[model samples]
Target: MQSTYNFWLVAISFAVATLASYTALDLTGRIFLLASARLRHAWRLGGAVALGVGIWSMHFIAMLAFSLPIPLGYDFATTACSLGLAIGASYLALVMTTRARLTALRLLSGGILMGFGIAGMHYTGMAAMDMTPGIHYQPGWFAISLAIAIGASSAALWMARALSNDDARNVFQKRSGAALVMGIAISGMHYAGMAAADFPLGAVCGAANGVNTIWLAAMVSLFTLAILIVTLMLSRFDARTTFLVGAVSKLNGQIIRLATLDSLTGLPNRATLTERVERAIQSSRRERSLFAILFMDLDGFKTINDSLGHSVGDDVLAAFSQRLLQCVRSSDTVARLGGDEFVVLAEHLASREDAGVLAESVLERMRHGIWSDSQPLQVMPSIGIALYPQDGDTVDTLLKHADAAMYEAKRAGRSTYRFFERSMNEAATRTLLIQSALHEALSAGSFTLHFQPKFHGGTDSLVGAEALIRLIDSKLGTLPPLEFIPIAERSGQIVQIGYWVVRETCRQIRRWIAEGLPAMKVAVNLSPRQLLQPNLVAEMLAIVQAEGVPCQQIMFEITETVAMQDAPKTIEMIREFQANGFEIAIDDFGTGYSSLAYLQRFRVKQLKIDRFFTNGLDEHGAEGSAIVSAIIALAHSLEMDVVAEGVETESQLDILKSMQCDEMQGFLLGKPLSANDFGDLLKHRTVAA
Candidate 1:
């Protein structure tokens, strides 16, 4: 009973040491990685070595505490050599691309290899040990010990690798049955090897029944079997704990990815970008180094999307992104903010001229464009360049200036480059003022819609009028569409403006009905926001019903640019609006991406041809006239009414009449006026008639 208790204590002590060693290794490993950020690979290797040493020390100490009869061996060099070989082999495997993504099986293979090394070391040490008095040459002990070490190492490596790969909670869920088998196998091998260890030949004192070699072998087999069962149980418990540790590791990886990466571009997103930029900026400021910020925009990308298709455009963008990365230095950073725009932070530029030269190089590379297949495609990048300290003191200032310069490049020639100018600041200030005023104007009811008569081409009689939204800023007087529309769109204030336009238009239509005036269709332009909103359809329907107006008399005009932004969504929206009895027209048809395919799919009732083509109809004759003629013909073929916009002169109106254009609206017909002014005009038209 006392012997049994002592055995239990020894087993418990070893188990406790095993647990403690693993806990210590995990804590040390985390600290090692955290401390060695710059030399991560070297530190990680050191950490592994440290863990092995720790384990080895713990095992030896525990054994000593147990006061086992096993004596110390000479030639500890074999143990060091084995460990070194194991570490070196593992490193080779880790570095190889073929084995870089290490799996449990590979780890197990490595562990087995290490086990051989460990076993060899153990046997060599045992062989050198002075055990009792004289033991003869024991080849069996060496072979058995070698095999036992190899098996144990293999099992340990496999278990460690498997546990590291899996999450603690999920390890049991995806339990590897083979892993458990390997564990049992390793324990069985150890017991068998120990039995085979040629202990000094001695006499059996109290075996009276039999003392044959076969009986001795049978006794060893039974002993090994009992040890195997116990080993298997212990291994299972250890595996469970290993899996839990693995789960924590995987969770940490996920957190790191989320914190550092931009999900869309698969690039160092905002957090990482800021960190890198801040570091670079600080270094530059301290060292008086020159760096450049390049703000890039793809020219006419929106047109390509509205014209060719968005999918083709996405391919263009992705390809362009790759090309942009190829143009920059390895030390530089390239990031995509979103949608047709990218930013490059170039470190350690030689001078301002260097920034310009790099910008030009990038622009030149972008000029040829990327060909997806055999087809040669063309892409243009407008790059705006800003230099550190000279252009701005901070990242935000540099980026903003660079962005402005990029637009300047676009305005000058597109597919070109430009450096930041002092004048850009004034322009930005003006834009900011306009944007601020727009919000105030919306709230104070300073925004009003003007309706301009759209006359039938042949009869020259008013058919319908288009509602144009205009904001009256107290300080800025009246702001034109050109002055504020783009700003509003960028600021996301267009949605509010669009909503007001629709509501006011509907109210005016209702007023006309109340006045018993002849029913005339009124068109209100819908911005991208108005169309994209899931609840927009419902809101518009509500307005129609509340106003008690015929939905057929109300028209919603969507720009070609906005329509192509999301074709599927646009198609659904148009169908829904049409179902509610509202007429849908493709606005600014020829000005932005001309896609005949969408005309077939869009279910649009009309096409509003922009005035640029119509204004020069007489001078360019056939070329200009043909463009208009083709659009009108295309609209006719699609069963769509063509409305010519920006018609100022009777000469343009004459051309439209000859082409049999359905309707027209432009400055010549009369600029957009307030609802009250439009009401007065309607009364004047009635009196004149």
Candidate 2:
């Protein structure tokens, strides 16, 4: 018997095949978009079941659509086996595609396997037919059918992958279009395989086969349509959920940035800086390398804020931060530690000099100055440097030491840099102690003045005395100038201490004059911190007047380092002091970088040689003697008097006397004495002469 197709049943079969194709593609698309691994696996398995059942149903329905001369019935066991093959094939395809990228190798392998599977299902279902003679397949048509299955399967998989890549855009439209194309391909493959089937003449169906063709076709169609509808609904829900999750993820990223970045400069804040430094430390420790931390404070930032207002100040800060960023490597971190203070963490340093080079670059860049609006701003950087495993090993210790070094840089005269040293930490501790003691000592009158007399080298007569400060604490005993003067300068207590020294020295001078002591100028050392004060000259004149001491009887001593810092300002202050009959002397003359021009510009009355040049005068071939001789010649040429310091040995005194040095003061002449003791010395010197 020859089979003939039923037109209406064939159309119904095509509709069922189309619906199954759309459902499978929709489910696969949804599975690809799922975020959770567990959910993706679950959905993939579920999709395999739906697709397998749908493909099986479409095939069976098409089988039911066939008409023949004899009745055909399917064997229940063989039919169920065909269904299993279809489901197994689908599961394998889903697993293969989901596990890895769909390379050409994977696509070809999956296509061949799925093609053989579909062919097996079709042939196995054909074998389910129980008739007088079993159904057979034409060799040529079978080949055509197999070709259709493999080609269609490969095309469908490639399309699915392509559509899923566009999931971020109009995904539903793309997937719907993909589903339409896949449906046509699957239905066409099914029809091609159906056309290969051949039944012999006079075939009769067996009673053991209980397949109902019409009812089975209707039931399969209804079941597939329901699955397709459910697949569509679930896909819509998944797409919406995915959009919300993506939005939430973006929001979380923004929150993270806000928490870690500075609002104005957009650089990392202190918290983020700390975290990055910790990470850098771990990396450096693992690699056995070094890193440096630089603490920077903007000089004259307060002046900018006061003069131009904070709005302009903020602009300057932002501009400066950008410049700073340009100076460092991308691997390094630059952070703002609030208001005019910034820090940099440089990692993976090959040597300590790398940090120095970077610091020099920063100084050079800032040397040109930063601009705010149209106005040019001049702000310098005072940087303190600390190295890992050398200065400190922890974040807090490193930052603390770096901060202390930064203050040291500022104290060394701003606009410079300093490295952390072990002694700096000790000095910092001592500074805190002295600061505490200084306040109490100042209040309790525990401070006393001592005078070291300066003598004329030729006459051996007293010419002047230098007033030195001493701090006497019940707990700490007496602290020398080295111990307390630096502490006072750093703590900003020098202004008060300097005023007290001037007042007491003047009062003592007046007392000596009343006791018939010959009048001699009393010299007081002025700290660099005091020289920067605007009222220093005025304060000294007022103290001299209040104590009834003539201005010519008092002299203010400033270090060469202090005077050379701002030459124009130093010259102006010196001229004002000289105009009022107060002598100005440069103490520690040879130790600093003061030029001969500055000495003449200030019209200084005297030059005091630093002790380092005088201490070694007794040694033969000592460079100290050569330096002392040169200084004496330089001072005399400028019409300025020379006083040699630290003259302990008679040999040093002999050298100075031969050099025609005007005066000498040290332990050899007389140690610094109490005011009463100095008065007695003066009286004895008068009697001796």
Question: Best TM-score goes to which candidate?
Answer: 1
> Against the hidden reference, what TM-scores do the models get?
0.61, 0.54
* Model 2, C-alpha of 12: deviation from truth (Å): 63
Off by over 4 Å in 1: 1-290, 296-324, 335-342, 347-383, 388-390, 393-397, 406-418, 565-569, 601-603, 686-689
| lDDT of candidates 1 onward, in order | 0.65, 0.81
Task: State model 2's lDDT.
Answer: 0.81
lDDT of 1 by residue, 491-545 (tens): 6688778877877888897777577665668898887655656688788888778
Candidate 2's residue-wise lDDT over 340-370, tens digit each? Answer: 9999999988888888888888887678745
Which of the numbered candidates is closest to the native, going by highest lDDT?
2
lDDT of 2 at 111: 82
